[model samples]
Target chain A: MNKFKTTESFENHISKEKRSAKAKAFFINFLLSFYLFFSLFFSSSYLIYEKNILPSFFYFILLAFSFIFSLLWTSKNSSLGSMAIYKTNKFLKNRKELQSEFNLFSFSGIFISLVLILTILLGSILVDINLYLLFSSQGLSGAKRIFSALFQPNWNIISQVLSSMVDTIFIAFLATFIAIPIAFFFSFFAARNLMKNSLLGNSVYTVIRFISNFTRSVEPLVWAVIFSVWVGVGPFAGMLALAIHSVSSLIKLYSEQIESVGQGPLEAIESTGAHPVLVVWYAVVPQIILPYLSFTIYRWDINIRMATVIGLVGGGGIGTLLVQYQGLAQWNEVGTIVIVIASVVWLMDYLSAKLREAIY
Target chain B: MSKTILEIKNLEKFYENGVHALKSVSFDVKQGEFLAVIGLSGSGKSTMLRCINGLVPSSSGEINFQGQDIISLKSKELRLARKSIGMIFQHFNLISRKSVLVNVLSGSLAKVSLFNGIFAKFSKKETDKAMSNLELVGLKDKAYIRADELSGGQQQRVAIARALMQDPEILLADEPVASLDPATSHSVMDHLAYINKELNKTVVCNLHFLSLVRKYATRVIALKDGKLVFEGSPLDIDEAWFKRIYGEQAREVGIE
Candidate 1:
């Protein structure tokens, strides 16, 4: 009886250690979540206040959901005899097929709860502050306001949208076009298999990599702002910003693609007494052409969306028109513009996918 | 006086990884002699051939081609010299996306100016010469087809055609039929032999198959671990000779 009791105590100690390890993991995850939440809260504080939003209800909902999730997760390995633990064990035993369904149900439940809580908080705050009076005086409330202010049957909004769209397309096109030639030179230096001198090759690679990183680190909107100060507003500033971003992204993609090309062709070219440039042209470029095209098209699609957003800060695109509509409190016009932009993006995505498939 | 078309004197190559790939290797080829370099893999056979064409720069050596010391030539002169020495690879490295015609045309780039080469502005005579070379390899009909579309044997033939378009004085074939089936290998070997004999071009080929070396080469040079093990006519080499060169490893692998 004494030996049996000793064994039982040892088993209890092992279980306690396992529980503590799991708790440590959970604490680390909770700390990460808290950091992310606070960062978002601080960054968007001005927007929240201007919109007459209170985040207290959101906090409550987050806390409740987190508590429930932690309970569910911990209960799976719980030593305590509870119905929840039994159910969790059974669910885990059949995990593969049931996992997606469980995750979908839980995620949607949390999301809906958060949205409801935030809406309720914002509604209460707006009511307390009498915000409806401000909207009424500005002709921003009710059905007639949006259409009257937006449509006014004026060509200004239409012309602005058209010009902005052109500028965005041109920015994407010119940047990609210019970047290809520059990347072509740097990719050879970057590829390890091609160059004989490791020191020289690595130095060239490092320098080019530094330039690419510096270009991509700054957002296009920030680039646009700097360029606007230097060269004045309109499409040229947007073009310059997009071009710099493209050089960095294109160099990285092109170098990686060049590096991965099969060594067989390269060796063959080398053995034939061909020059390095010839080897690259005949061997490397042929293999990477399809992938390069696919990447360029994808970048162009991303640039189109970014171009619109950058225009809000005078980068010159559809974003300019959207901002103007917002200033005039024309929500219906904003909705129409949003739909048009979405359709354009969707069309480009479909076309790009088809083209990529055809090439491959 | 008989001209020494190619000569290597005390050629040495030490890889950056500190491997002595070739140690004081030396050999010579007359204007029209077919030489077979027989060696196992990693036995300095490839490094020896690449050094002849100046493809891999020798650490300390003198490669005299026709009379000039090619080892000391700078980039422009080296490129010009390379145009005269044609090479073929084991895997037939034709650009898969390019047609056979364009692949053959690529060989002529060293002879043409960089601007014209980039723009692909070869004269009509150059095109005709390329076509004739393709005809010599019996791949004239497939000249317009993308190289990837061809069979292994056919692609090797296309590579041969490309090399022939260079109008080279020396031809170096690095295991040209290693990737092909036995039947295809025989045909490719026949084509290389025909090019050597009919065109009177000096041929130096690296080969593993002894039967092929016996059938094609006038003289066979064997290497064992970056050292010259055998240098004699094909008739002089027997199973015992191969055994001596490859050692007990040959017996284990059952190459005899």
Candidate 2:
């Protein structure tokens, strides 16, 4: 009796497995067909809209063809979870034999490749790309003139470029220095884990998070424009702009570090009856100090790159000199400023990377 | 007869996710007894230990410790109350990057002013006491090393030393040996046993193995599905009671 029961249960298990496999195959096929139809229809419609030469009837016909092709292919092929399709009733008796029916190149693979090529073609049309025009006489001459002038940089402006480069670097330095303490103060309030206890704490968390997010959404260029109007066009304006953005960015980095701190040490310190400040000092500080230093060094690197650009908006630095020389069409002077900025940015990036490596 | 130092009445804890971690449970702890709370995982053992120290506030209960209800205490009062109750975790929750000596000295932050605590300026007396506690845990030589550099057993021993620096009246240990190997578990347990017997501090510990309870605990309490199932001497939990507490399919597994 036990042997008979075991045989029956084994049959039941196999039947259940077969049913689940069938359902899974159907779901996968349905999703693939739906995706194929959408991609084909959308790409064709986008092409017709952007090019605007094809008629409305042409789009409708393409859409209908995609829909009908996906439907008919899905119904006829009925993919069997792998590359094989369900074609005959004979293979239904043994699922294991279905593996031998695998195809090296399937219709779905061909259809997907066709759709990808169509997408690339549509992207070229959308961008209004004309590769032939780029290598035309007019384009080559424009490029040649800039290249010849750039190769002959004006050495007379080397002293001016060096001094303005120092100003740009100092703006980044002072901005980061000012932002460090402010971001450190706001980060504790912004961390959800730290301020989740009371209604007042939750409100402070929301307010700090909202203000940082709001300020961060405004790009440094826009902020530099605003600060130039307020503080008058100088390195101070650039410094203020970078400082504001850095505080928000650093708050986000610092608070996320605080949230991921191991709760074990925090609980241990709390259990010691330490004051709340001391709990944060002892537990949270040790875990976050290295990460915070790493993030600050990273932020300083970004600020240096931004300061060079912020000077373009009348905030005084090497960027102001480059823009001035460009406006006058003195490409040689512009080339000198460009080289100074590039070399400085590269050195800053390398130093920050090394500093971050040392910290970790 | 020993005096009851801690009294818990109808202790109920409902977590924010609507998990009823602890049902209406009540128990008493004597002044100097080593009480072992045993249960399966998620049976409210950790939650109960946390609630007693006001770490995880009880949903509704009265935990009377030294003439004060721990659940009703304000933040300042809670900090003051927590000073007398030293707790250690299974993970040995030391500030991993800090020196072992600094980790121990952090336990005295409750009594120091906020200004002094901020600068981590402990007095010579406190430093000496921290050293003595490290010596008690047989880790005086390891004091200058980083807390994370130690082995698991050594880290746990340092955690015990840090807890001892508080000079607490009651020590709550949450599954102190659950993360340790059997041999290391015995060594840590021996230190706890020494604290309970020689120093005469009341020790309330959460444990998993019945054999360890039989060896170390003066009294045992068993919890099942958030309800107290048994409260008696450890030796009284024989085969029948064990089967009932741990479920019928369960069999005792010994570490040694």
Candidate 3:
């Protein structure tokens, strides 16, 4: 009788634990539903006020239906409730899985936030003056006008596009070429394992990082305009601007690549009585070189496109031609220039992909 | 008896995060002697080996190698000191992208100048020497192959060859076969033993398995919680001694 009672009580205890878990899950989900409803209400109100646009009452109706649907779903599917709780409870049960999930979530969140911020900033600027206003001020209108002007094959338009493209390409190339050596020095200081003294290493890294941020923050177009006033219009001004930006970007990428290298090879090199610089050259550089090359090529391709845009401000290359075409109301020519630029960018993309495959 | 080639006097290291990695450890290694350090994780065995090569700077201690205090040596002097001591890691850390030949040649970086090193302007003699080292590790055929192309055992052989290229007087191996299979572990240990016997190089190795240490180590040192608890011959280390060194708690945890 005593043994039977013990068995029965053990079974009862397990069932009680299960019941409490279910209850906890249900309560948590109920809170989530309430929070969502509140958030929906406030978001809808804010959207209406900000945009001066009312979403149809149907959206509110849909929200109410969804909430009701979720409640019913949770009641029937305790398994689903368990899964939802599992996300939060995961760290206690399986640490590796939790860490990986957290990493992915945070990385994606940061990336999405950056994209949203950039889009909003750019949209606000573009919406005010508008691309149409800038184009219409020169008296070019309709797709027909653009087509005719392009079909007529004006040499002036062709020349302007060619120059801008050349200027852009040259700027990217020159900037990258000049920045590579400098970035190498900065990356050495940035690498955690390379430097023994953390304070000195961190200070060096911070200073270089600050310099890079400052350089990259000032857009190439702005830099070109500033340089144009200082050195007058040409490819030289554009090159300087791109070079400054390249230094900052390359340093960041290179340093990160350096940091990610397996410490094993470095430890091996250090053990062999190799100097710090030698260790870096052997262990660190070998690991990072392929990735660095790929990043550089990609950056160069981007700079070429930017160089063309910056040329409108007289920094030199195809942008100068683009500006001239717009001033002359030659929209068709502008379209042709855009096509050529797109083709070049596409070519770079294909080549870089192939090269990365070969190296990697 | 051979002269004492290396001496450690009250060597201590405390990490910036306040982990007492090594606590006032002292030992001497004679020329051409084979010493195996046996310990579980966080035992300060690896830390002690790193201090000899000046890889991990000692917080308060003196490492005297060839009658010179290695701890006080700065930049170039440190590099010069490092050249005489070669190290092998458990993971066989080779530059995966580079060919085996280039990996081996990396060991000679200390002797070569910065300009030659960067551009890989290694002399024909240096190249031949690297090839010979590869031959010693029996990977001469895999010279042109990338380091990643080889198996774990093969990669370890390549690493050994890379260290040999340094023509080091002392070889420090930190759990060099921890990543390999049992059969491969024996082979790698055999190679290390052969190197010690043939080249008359002083070898201090950190080992996980006691069997391997018994087979190779002339002198065994055991560490527990950053403290050296046992320093004696292999024959002297019986099961009871091991129990004392590891403790009943560690035995229950299955540390062996």
lDDT of 3 by residue, B24-52 (tens): 77888888889999877888988888888
Q: Pick the candidate with the highest lDDT.
A: 2
Worst 10 residues of 1 chain A by lDDT: A78-87
C-alpha local distance difference test of each model: 0.73, 0.86, 0.75
- Segments in model 1 whose C-alpha atoms lie over 4 Å from true places: A1-167, A177-209, A262-285, A323-338, B1-3, B251-256
Instruction: For residues A1-360, write the lDDT of model 2, one tens digit per residue.
Output: 011122244456556645554555455555555555555555666656643455568656656664555445544332433323322322233445433343436665665576577667656756778988899999999999998898889999899999999999999999999999999999999998889877788999999999999999999999999999999998999999999999999999999999999999999999999989889989998999999999999999999999999899977898788888989999999888888899999999999999999999
Shares of reference contacts reproduced by the candidates, in order, are: 0.32, 0.71, 0.58
| lDDT of model 1 at position A197 | 41
Q: How should the candidates be ordered by lDDT, best one leading?
A: 2, 3, 1
The numbered model that scores best in TM-score is: 2
lDDT of 1 by residue, A1-360 (tens): 011122244345445544554565455434433434433453356346654254678777666665556555444333122212223442232324322232324543454455455555545554566666757855554556656543443443556666667767787678768777776677667665665444566677777778777878999889989988888886777778887887778777878888888877776665455667777777788898889888888878777878777777777777777778878866766766676678777887888788878878
Model 2 in CAPRI terms: which quality?
acceptable
TM-score of chain A of 2: 0.70
Error of 1 at B89 (Å): 0.6
lDDT tens digits, residues B63-154, model 1?
99967888788766776787788899888888899899988888776666656766778889889988998898898998899999999999
**Candidate 3 on A1-360: residue-level lDDT in tens?**
011112244345445544665565566555455444444454455546644243578556656765665566455333234445534442222323312232324533453454455556545643554676657745555655777766665455566566667667777788788988887678777655555355676677677777877887889888888888888888898888787777778878888888888988888877777767778888888788889888887777777777777778987777777788789886767777767778787887788778777877
